[model samples]
Target: MAYKISEDCISCGACESECPNQAISEGSSTYVINPDKCTECVGAHDSSKCAEVCPVDACQPDPARKETKEALLARYKKLHP
Candidate 1:
């Protein structure tokens, strides 16, 4: 599933660099995750790197954009390949 930054984000930019798909970007008030580009690091990592490094645990899955592992892997290949 794609991840999103909550209001709890401190604007530290930690998740931006960690996103292998370049899906995370600075929003008006917080970091935003582009669901179309977010693969949850499926082919890149075992878990979400952004969530792992977020200082305030602001990175969390977007329940509205739920996705399966196979779907995420397909997205990863489409992006990387």
Candidate 2:
């Protein structure tokens, strides 16, 4: 599943550089995650780097964008290739 930035986000830009897919970007107030480009780091890392590095734990999976590992990997491949 793709991750979403929550209100807990401090707008510190901590997660912007960590996303392998470049899915995260600065929003009006907080960082936003592009669900179409997010892959939960399936092919880039064993786990989500944005989530791991988030100081406020604002990076969370979006249930609304639920996806399996295979699907995530496919997206990663598509993005990387």
Candidate 3:
């Protein structure tokens, strides 16, 4: 599944740097995750690095974009390949 950053984000840039897929970026008000590029760190790490490093816990899975591990892995491969 792709992850998203909520309004709670402090725009600390911590999540941006930790994103292996370069999916997180500073939005007009907060950090935003590009769903197309976001693989939830499936190919890069065991967990979402953005959530791991976000100070305010603003990064979390997007319920609307929910996907299975196999689906995520497919996306990760498509992205990296």
Q: Which candidate wins on TM-score?
A: 2
TM-score of each model, in listed order: 0.95, 0.96, 0.94
lDDT of each: 0.92, 0.93, 0.90
Per-residue error at 45 for model 2, in Å?
A: 0.4
C-alpha RMSD values across all candidates: 0.8, 0.6, 0.8
Q: List the residue pairs that clash in candidate 3.
A: none
Model 1: residues with Cα > 4 Å off, grouped in runs: none
Error of 3 at 30 (Å): 0.3
Instruction: Summarize candidate 1's per-residue lDDT along 1-80 as a digit string, tens digits.
Output: 78888999989998898889999999999989999999989999888999999999999999989899999999999998
Q: For model 2, where is the 10-residue window of minimal lDDT?
A: 61-70
Model 3 lDDT per residue over 1-81, tens place = 799999999889998889888888889999899998898899889988999998899999999998988888888898788
Candidate with maximal lDDT: 2
Per-residue C-alpha lDDT of model 2 across residues 41-75, encoded as one tens digit per residue: 89989889999999999999999888899999999
Which regions in candidate 3 have their CA more than 4 angstroms from the true location? none
